[model samples]
Target: MKILIVEDEQEMLNNMRQSLEQELYIVEAASNFKSATEKIGVYDYDCILLDIGLPDGDGLELLKYLKKQGKDDGVIIVSAKDSLDDRLKGLDLGADDYLPKPFHMAELNARIKAVLRRRNFDGNTLVEIGNVLIDTESRIIKIADEKIILNRKEYSILMYLIANKTRLVTKTALAEHVWGDHIDQTDSFDFIYSQIKNLRKKMDKATITVEAVYGVGYKLEVE
Candidate 1:
């Protein structure tokens, strides 16, 4: 999973990066509000650990902005504030959870897992679509009772498609969700088509169909 850590203290940020990276999570850091805002505008993160106190602006404002943009990324406030008002305000602003300073790294990790579970798997450890089952915690995908090994990008594509199953997803949406701001420099979307084709060929059951919409995009149909 990808995570963004927004904290002003350089030492604290480094510690957070080390702790999260040890758990096999891709970590990115931002020291202030401007840098955090820029990162949020570009990358697609599964979770964001934001400090409520920043050099330029309040983290709650950033949370509100993310919500306004209709981004469903999970957010957690990791600040030194432990007051009732602060926690309540952060929660009201759509924070998934709040952690005060001097927290154990293990506890933070647990909270991150819990937030991800609620956001992506409906609090279930496994995500099942038809005959395919994915263990979100284990990052394992199984098809027809057999385990299937998939590359990171392939797995991400499958998860994104399954998350919005039965909905017509445009190429631009897929690119943005997968590649974020970097998609703008790409010359063509043929690579997206190829990835979808490769994913379909790996499925054991042919019941699920990923249909193209000609000039638009693709939709996954279970008919």
Candidate 2:
């Protein structure tokens, strides 16, 4: 999983990055609103930790921008603001949870897990589709009781495809989701095709198939 932390305070941002990285998430951060806005517009994250009082803009406005763009990344407002109005406005703007600052790291972790559960995996730790079983915590994939080993990028690709199994995941979406900010640095989607080809080979015996849509994108088909 991946996360974006948007906070103006350097120390607070470091703390969040360290804590969430310890939980095995690929973590990235932006200290101000402009940087955060740019990152959010270009990349996709599994979750976003947004602070209300940013240096250049309010975190609530960031949520509104996300709404306008139709991105459904799970958001947890990690603000120093504890007012009921602040919390209510965040929720009304589609934040998954509001976490008051000066909170325990354990509590923050719990809330993030809850949001991810609801948004990504239907409240289950094990993601199963037909014969394939994935353990989100351990990042393990098992097909028909047989274990499979995948490198980090391969695993990320597999999980993203599984998450949007029913839809045709466009190449642009797949690249941005898996590669994050680094996607823009690449010349083409040859890396994406490489990962998808490897993933197809790895799961050849499984009931699911990854199909290319010819000039469009790819779709995961479950036999």
TM-score, every prediction: 0.56, 0.56
lDDT accuracy of residue 106 in candidate 2: 44
Worst 10 residues of 2 by lDDT: 102-111
lDDT, candidate 2, 123-157, per-residue tens: 47888898999888898889999999989988877
lDDT of each: 0.81, 0.84
- Model 1 local distance difference test score: 0.81
Clashes by residue pair, model 2: none
**How far out, in Å, is residue 8 in model 2?**
0.8
Best by lDDT: 2
